[model samples]
Target: MTLRPIRLLAGAALSLALASCGTTYSMPGIADETNSRASTMFAEAKTAAPRSPISESAGVNRFARVARRIEPVARQLCETELAQGKAVDCDVKLELDREMQQRNAYFTYAEAGNRSPVIRFSVPLLQDTGNDDEVAFIMGHEYGHLIGRHIQKGQQQAIAGALILGVITAAASAQGGGYYDQTAVENSMELGAMVGQRAYSQTYELESDMLGTRISHAAGYDPVKGAQFFARDEAARSGGGQLSFWGTHPPDEKRMAMVLATMEQIQGQQALTRKASQ
Candidate 1:
């Protein structure tokens, strides 16, 4: 029997509380250690890639110029969410990584003793990206993840799922007067966590894309071109099969469609604002 609908509703309710809670950056622990490891990896990758430093590359300079313009705008939006109690205050840091070949970017919570969230852009992505709008859109998307607190929400949801499954496993075993071995309990909990992680994966991606559309537009970039990147990627993945049911992200085509929808919404809102101003 499918319990997904019920599970989704419960998870959503729990997420409200989880998402609203603020983060504490006091002592170092696993999270801090993980952050340190990632930073070290980025640093090491720089030397390993053998590319000119981002500071010395003209293309990267152009990328940085656009990033500088969008950073403050993105932070202001994040601050607005904080003021409205939608999120905890988080400093936003944009860094360029000139070593990784992958065209990728990510947002992570700040290291211990630091309250700022960090966004890293791979050098190849910066160099190969179509234009300024694409870069701004990508940065804004990472900011969207930060303000939305998706990472924290995902962790909380996973723990909730694990706990719920653990209880169910014990109760079911007791009712049936059957053995519930520790191994079975552990396996159930692990499976629950895996399910929980996938629960909001697509939703988070779409919401971030929507928020990113508004953000990039507000930062004076055309979101249409921002969306082209996905369509281009989708074309490249044409031979790939449909996204798996257990996947943690929406398919590229779905993401492209979402970007288009979000762009339309933003444009409509802007038109209304312009009309109201006159």
Candidate 2:
């Protein structure tokens, strides 16, 4: 459901305490779709697809290595470019034994969404062949979440949804003299919330892809080459029948296009030794 539906439910009471609440989605159809577009885009650039990385416990170390390489650059980029002159006050911690056995690296603010915002990566490298570029790119992807401010924005969206929902319900009951159509009210509220949420959450990914590109470039890594990892994987998994490339992420083709466009802009700056001040 979209976030707009949630907000409508909250209705006009958002002035109050709005605080509250709240892929690859790579099932069968998902992968095949990614493969077609991601594959073509990468192939045109002569970028070879990568085999699936190992998925065992041994792989975490590999993921960690990649995260380490990119963390410095990602943090620096945020502080210098995205943070708007705010200092980045956070830490990166590695684990040799995680009880939950999570397969992915994650980003968590040290402040826990309160004050000192921090983004942490918590996965080891792939257990398969240790491709640092791919691993770093993976790390870059998680870090991309923070650069995009998905964390805080996500919280705000949730609260907005909840606030709208509560207000809508309360107001409907009051206006209807304690008699309201439950189904109609529910359907309307849900639809509105979904629209609002999607607009805020889903659309930011392309911009994040662009931001990630700038990050990879600044870190002294090959953003173009690093992107090849996603390009190759997206195409292979997308197989040949998937429909939307952005089943979860930015569509493979769209992401490729954005990254390329961003590359052109940055390379021009590099040639001129241009430095970003904000």
Candidate 3:
């Protein structure tokens, strides 16, 4: 579910998968750099997040730890939401690729943009996990996509993404194609096109967090683990939480408060149910 260089590579195909969306943010001379990023992310996902020996690079192994915490929550969301009555299949991975710099994470829905999606974490931006909440939260966020059927929802986002890239491309054409303008086009593609979709994207994120809490709590991981990821005070003003405005994310404190509030709600319901059982 890792995003690739082509998505951000200035030109790629998205007609087949959610991965087909070409990047408007890629500058002319930097396609190779983006490819390196794509390669690195794929390598990391194959090695780190799997349950076996991480034969790939080990620098980003921390994200894999978080991905492990994510599996149960992801499966539960799919089972409950889709009524599949079976384990939800998912692959959660992380990478240090910079092409996905604008995307702290994403739900790459399916092969035909139809099946269960994989969750990609931007390794460049991810903090190493110690308590394991960030992974749970991220998994929850992606599982929320499954609950909300974000693959189908992503069709709408695709239009928004494409349009964003189109406008920037037009702007670049008008500006005589200087390297500076080209770079502007790329940023515009990400910030203008992809960023505008932040409202729904952020909504998906928060919804995932809520659902993740339920899944994690049920599975025995502290639901608060996911929320604590958003508690970093420094990054929140610039970056915290997901599926919201593009200034990075919600304020760290605000996200933590929201997660805690959600937890309390979940706990209250669980307590009520237990009392009734008694």
Candidate 4:
């Protein structure tokens, strides 16, 4: 078999596979004005004094309150936005990770029975939040993951990437008229999986932020203020030195800009609705 044919086939398959994954919803476009404002805000956050962490009890109470409001809004949005006939689980469960020391939150399916979708917030992350809006915004962001079907897409991408790379590696090894190099193909597959899984990572984050803005606003929270949670120059690791929130959700001016742009879109939509009603 010619290496060129195998390479071409692998490339075509890879493109097709990756193209099948990604966001189902459109992301908001960032205007120059919003970008400038986000830059200023990001700069200001760096110099701003750190606020005191809320007491653990206060944080828990705040989380409970925010969850009560955000959960329904998120579920409704998920159900409304998801295409009809899709089987995505809109009933997302909210949980507090009391045992975790890191400041972080994540959305994932439960490992055991039924595999229900769950969003978990660490106690430290809750205490670190500045307000109820921040809590609501973060929760909504996690909900975005579910609505976007990021986890599922990521899994698909990983499999595609691995297969494509493995095929290419095997073909290249065979080009020498030698036995298949299993070790080389396996190593390449592992690398491919990692690369593919992260291919849309940034885009996914922005998509989540965009959806998060709408969800937070519907829950009656200021998303721009809530997004300030990302502006600070805080450690990505927890006090215990484990990777935490900032590690995964790195601080980026573009994210702030995306949130601002999304809010603008939301406001414009609301105004149009009001005018239509009038």
Best candidate according to TM-score: 4
Residues 14-104, model 2: lDDT tens digits: 6432432211111112244444655577666445543464666556666555556677877776665334643344344433334332233
Candidate closer to the true structure by lDDT (higher is better), 1 or 4: 4
Q: Summarize candidate 3's per-residue lDDT along 1-278 as a digit string, tens digits.
A: 11233245333323323442322111122244444543443333324321222222342565666555557556655666446543344443333444553325666644654454566665433543334555556556556666665445556455556555755465456556444455655665565445434436555555555666666666566866555444433333123323322234553333344455566677678899999999
Cα lDDT over the full model 1: 0.62
Q: Give the range where candidate 3 is weakest over 10 consecutive residues by summed lDDT.
A: 21-30
Candidate 4 error regions (>4 Å): 1-12, 81-83, 235-242
What lDDT does the true structure give each of the candidates? 0.62, 0.52, 0.49, 0.85
The numbered model that scores best in lDDT is 4
Candidate 1 segments whose C-alpha is farther than 4 A from its true place: 1-56, 234-250
* lDDT minimum window of 10 residues, candidate 2: 20-29
Worst 10 residues of 1 by lDDT: 237-246
Minimal lDDT window, size 10, model 4: 235-244
Structure candidate 1, residue pairs in collision? none
Per-residue lDDT of candidate 4, residues 87-159 (tens digit): 6998788999888887899999999999999999998888878788888889989999998889988887887
Model 4: per-residue Cα lDDT at residue 250: 80
lDDT of 1 by residue, 69-99 (tens): 7888878877887788665556777787666
TM-score of each: 0.72, 0.60, 0.50, 0.92
lDDT of 4: 0.85
